[model samples]
Target chain A: MSEVTAPMAGKVIDVKVNVGDTVSEDDELIILEAMKMEMPLVAPTSGTVKEIKCKKGDSVGADDVLVVIE
Target chain B: MLDMVMTTGVVHLTVGNLIMWLIAFFFIYLAITKNYEPLLLVPIGFGILIVNLPLTYLMQEGEGLLWKFYHYGLEWEVIPPLIFLGLGALTDFGPMIANPKTLILGAGAQFGVYVAFFGALILGFKIPEACSIGIIGGADGPTTIFTTVHLAPHLLGATAVAAYSYMSLVPIIQPPIMRLLTTEKERKIKMRQLRPVSKKEKILFPLVTVMVICLIVPASAPLMAMFMLGNLFKECGVVKRLSDAASNELMNIVTILLGISVGATMSAEHFLKPEVILVFIMGLIAFAFSTAAGILLAKFMNLFFKEKINPLIGSAGVSAVPMAARVSQVVGSKADPKNYLLMHAMGPNVAGVIGTVVAAGVFIALAG
Candidate 1:
């Protein structure tokens, strides 16, 4: 399993995938808003989504695991 | 006695005072109606109005509020460095670190500083005066004020106003030069996405930059050191309150005092001179040359690189913060609406700030 992390501390404004969904590398997984900029978090590898650890409106810290891919 | 009392204030007014009133009104108009740097021009405009009034003693040698502000805040070299602290706190070094090559573009833009320096000398300005005037090309007002106060205090009024005026006019002054220097294809070139800069790198950049710059040019340590400290405050994550104060409360108070003090220096006898006119003219040339030099250097660099950089970003090398960079984006979008050049342009834009400081350091070291 590969865990995708938040690059910075921010509020997750969107979640674009669900568990059991197939995803491609670099696909947008979440939209994080921080420092007045909207940053799209992307998948690090192509895999099936095994878990979603963050949700819309969740405040996340830098390096916090947001998704699990297998 | 009754007649004299009625006309006392009225009798003190002169043609020069009236003319200065008009100029001050024009600045206020620009600030209120045209929305040009109101944060600066408004206070400065009001200060000009107060000082131009005859016999008020509002700007008297040692007694007036405005004079005190000027002497304590600017002449003593306190406010400009504080302003840099705020600027550093607000600045993000991510883009510059992501693409370090833009530092060269920033250096290339300093071509304007030398152009204006030589131009001022040929026009009969003394060396120190010319040095202050040339820095108007850098398009960074705090640095301009800092340099002028140290080197040529008398020209402070004209140089500060000229630096800021040209800075606000970046959208107007830079586009023509950018267009004149580059081809359509060059303007349309799309740069690759910048890689993300790690947080560790961001934390180290200010410390390493301060050490390197101070070692190379000790004259810049005061300004650069404060700037780096502010950035460190912001990046450290533990000093959120200090960073907030630097960017907000402290910045606001210093800006108000600095603006009014800069305006107070523009007494009629001091401001209405042939040299002042020459300074304004030199300021225009400085902006033009800075923009052209950045674009030319980018074009020159393209000869060596496999992937071409959109040369419009070069015009952003003048250090007017996001304004010059925004102008680059607007012009690039005109050429190709799909182009997203803002982030790419920011690399050079921020670098221009450091470049201007280094250039000022060189001037102080060599000339002062």
Candidate 2:
């Protein structure tokens, strides 16, 4: 499993994928908010969402884990 | 007879050139006293004064090194792109990635380029020159300089002054246009927070942006390549020191030299023509149109969503960076102090930079 990390410093605006949901490469995993813009965290490869790391409204730092993609 | 050789051909400065000196002084005063964009204006102002001193050896072959810098650097298009590299180091794509929708706002703002292009055309300016002059509306300094140096070399002085002047006056020029276009209720519309991007995404962003831009606008490769190189140095996280130097020291040095070099282009022989007045007028028109296009795009975006977005942020699509973003905040605050749109404005503001670059590519393809 590979960990999907926050790309930048921002608040979590939304979680698009849920744990156990199968996803394809480049599918958005969660929404990270920064600079008043929404950044989507996407899957690295086709995989199932194994674990959700952060909740909505949580402030995530650069490189902070958002989800585990397996 | 020996002294006559030295006295002869001591060229007298003309009234037109003297008038150029006065205008240059105005910018110098604005930069020093009013604290206008001193970084660019002060040196540029001085350059104008020094270069215009009739028969002065400042920019001439035997005058001084200033002319060499202008000829070898600006004329050759070496300096402006390097300046862009510094700007790229300073820019944070976070705002853009957070709200990729703002990319459209950036694109929308560039409608002014075409609008101004035709405006210049209607004013009896030819296509290539008009296209170069029209680009000043994009409000991107490097792009303006780049286009002028290539498409309309003679118009460089007027176009650069207009671009930087309007950029400094952004606080003044934009508010009235923004206010007249939107109702108070529309100004208060607040947007929701942007989503988070992944670390891998940040790492890949500069690379991807470069690839996309290069494939789409190969003419802008030099600009895009240098810009992305700086961004990569910044986002890579492993090169903080290099990023710091590039963003600060390197940029500062280049700006000083480039400002003076740009100012040197304002020789009266070229700048005092009747066409210069028209170029100045067209620059303002371009700026206004870009801002209007942003507001209109915001209204368009509002149609799709129930939660209204602040249309004022749309004007930040003019690519002046934090200045445009600050204009958004100022306008938002006057409506309601709690309505801080600075961050929200940044998304499109950054995108505006990209938008301007893309617009430059279009001109380079069509005009270059």
Candidate 3:
């Protein structure tokens, strides 16, 4: 499965799923706050999480593969 | 006994009317061809066509359909509040919430509003007239009309037309100033990522801000309340119908009335004055300064932050709404396909809208 990445650089405000959670396409898994706005990082496809690269309060960049769904 | 006659009423439409028609035609053409803010310009252009025909009963002392709409819809202050409702519906407060610092950029963008207001005062306009004209710098349509009708009723025509006309030309007016102020290297700067905000935070923000802003500037309460209310509806996730109306049918109806009313303000006697020229020139200056202010503020922020901010997004802080925000992103993407600054720019972009409303309140308080 492909990695779901961040759309922009921002602080990780929240991670909706714990490690080992199953997800599907368009399921919001993370919230990144940029420009004083909350942008959700939705799963690109259905997958089981193999990794969660960041946590709450972590900063991330665009296309930084946020979660690995296997 | 003898009767002398000018050209037949229909044929009496002279070269001046023809020239005005050409102006309307060009505005329509630009709006259609260039894909600028056509939603506004196309209607305003059509209004120019209808009203500028010398002896047309459209704007005579009696009831003309448009004149009736203009008098009741805009003059009585009906459409602006509703337009604000629509705007509030469409506005996303996320960027402002996520990057609270961008509010500074929004505040900075209002420098032009005051600067232009002062410019108008120095040009012999009275305080109220100056205030209305000055708001053109905010780059917002309803704010321009609201301030003008309330403060300097006479200059309403020039101020409104200039505000909308320049808005439709933002893509053209902003780029040159952006180029003039920044080096290509600076334009290409990649900004740091923003923090995440919870849905709870999103839901609470508008509520808290309403108290803060309305308390600070009571005159701003109407526009600000309408604005925050729209965001509230959008965020609460329970009132989808209200959000849909605010963004669509309500906004569309208000826009139609607002555009024509503002366009109706542009009559030859009112629009052909030397002050009108001043309004136009001050508009360009206001746009340039707002862009500069946004860039400079972002540059200032870069000193404390580890990852540099893309200063280009600062230029979007003027209240051109999503257009300015989109421009920031497009400019960034041109430098690096990987870069997307639209949402980042929107933080200040939306903030600029509120800031301008606050600034308008300041003017109304002082000028009134």
Candidate 4:
């Protein structure tokens, strides 16, 4: 399994994928709200989602695991 | 005696007062009907009406509340920098970092400022007055106010009005020049997608910018410092309250005071001058020249760049913020709707704001 970490400190506004969902590289995985703007965190590599570690309204810090894909 | 006291207003009326009243009404009409920057024009329109009323003491020397506000807010050079703080909170610099080279387009837009500077000088305005007039090209209202307050406070009203007026008309003034400068193929050129900016980079941007700019042109510190501070508040995420306050409440209050004070300065004696007309003319020229300059520079850069940039985005360097950037998108859409230039255009659009402030700082160092 590969980890997708939170890139910034923000509240996760949405989780676009569920466990076991297949994703392509650069596909938007979640929306993070910071600096009064919404930023979408995309997948770094193509993989099938093995676990969802973050959910909507979860406060996250940089490098915190958000999703695990395999 | 009672009738005479009541009739004093009629007795004091003059043609100048009537003309000013008509002008005030025109401003109000534009604000309400056309929505031409109503946040500024509405307050300015009402203030002009209030100040122009015959025999009113609202603009009286050292006694009028409006006069006091002008003295404290503008003359003291407080409002503009404070307004910058709010602007910082609203602005996002991600596009700029993602496309660092677009900063040159921002620098290119300042060509209009110098063009107007020399034009004003040739037309017989003193150096200080010329500097104030030239900044209208920057197309940022608060920067215009800050420069005018420092360099030529007397020209403040005309310059401020002209700046905001032209800014609202960016959709009109920019398109023709944009069309004139580039071919349809160049306009339709699609730029590569920008890489996403990292969060640590966003937080560090303000701190590093302040250090570099303040050290180079200390005159720009008050405005630049407050602007960067506001950005820090937003990026740090620890000071959400400060950022929220700066963007909403503080911005609203300062804008009200700034608009009214600016309008109050438009007394017939102060505003109805040959030079004021020249200032307005120079302002239009500044904007046109700036647009042309940005487009030309982009064309010139294409000679070297491997990946061609859509030249339409270059005109957004005039710093009208999202409006100038939007014009690029609209113009590009006419050529090819598939091209998405708004995000790309924003790189230069936001950079233009920084470029204008820096240009204003240079003038302050040399002239102020």
Q: Tell me the DockQ of each model, to 2 decimals.
A: 0.06, 0.02, 0.09, 0.05
Q: Write the per-residue lDDT of candidate 4 for residues B159-246, one digit (tens) a residue.
A: 9999999999999999999999999889889888678788899999999999998899888898899999999898889999999999
Evaluated on chain A only, model 2 obtains a TM-score of: 0.93
TM-score of each: 0.85, 0.82, 0.82, 0.84
Models sorted by DockQ, best on top:
3, 1, 4, 2
Where's the lowest-lDDT run of ten residues in candidate 3 chain B? B1-10
TM-score of chain A of each: 0.96, 0.93, 0.91, 0.94
Q: How many clashing residue pairs are found in candidate 1?
A: 0
Name the candidate that leads on DockQ: 3
Give the C-alpha lDDT of model 1. 0.89
Q: What are the per-residue Cα lDDT tens digits for candidate 2 across B1-368? A: 76765554334667877898898999999999999899999999999988887656677764577978877777787888788788888887876897888888988999888889999999999887898888899998888988888788778888888899889989999999999999999888766756666667777888999999999998887778888888888888998998888889988888888899889888888788899889989999999999999999999998996767789989999999888887887787677643547777888898888888888888888888
Q: Which stretches of candidate 2 lie over 4 Å from their true place?
A: A1-70, B1-11, B61-64
lDDT of 3 by residue, B61-111 (tens): 457877787778877778887888888878778778888888999999888
RMSD of each: 5.8, 10.7, 7.5, 6.3
Per-residue lDDT for B1-368 in model 1, tens only?
88877566677787878888898999999999999999999999988889988768878879998889999999889999999999999998887899898988888898899999999999999999999999999999999999999999999999999999999999998888888988888888977767778889999999999999889988887789989999999997899999999999999999999999988998888899888999999988988999999999999999998978889998889999988888887788677644557777888999999999998999999889
Q: Model 3 lDDT vs. the true structure?
A: 0.80
Model 1 interface CAPRI class = incorrect
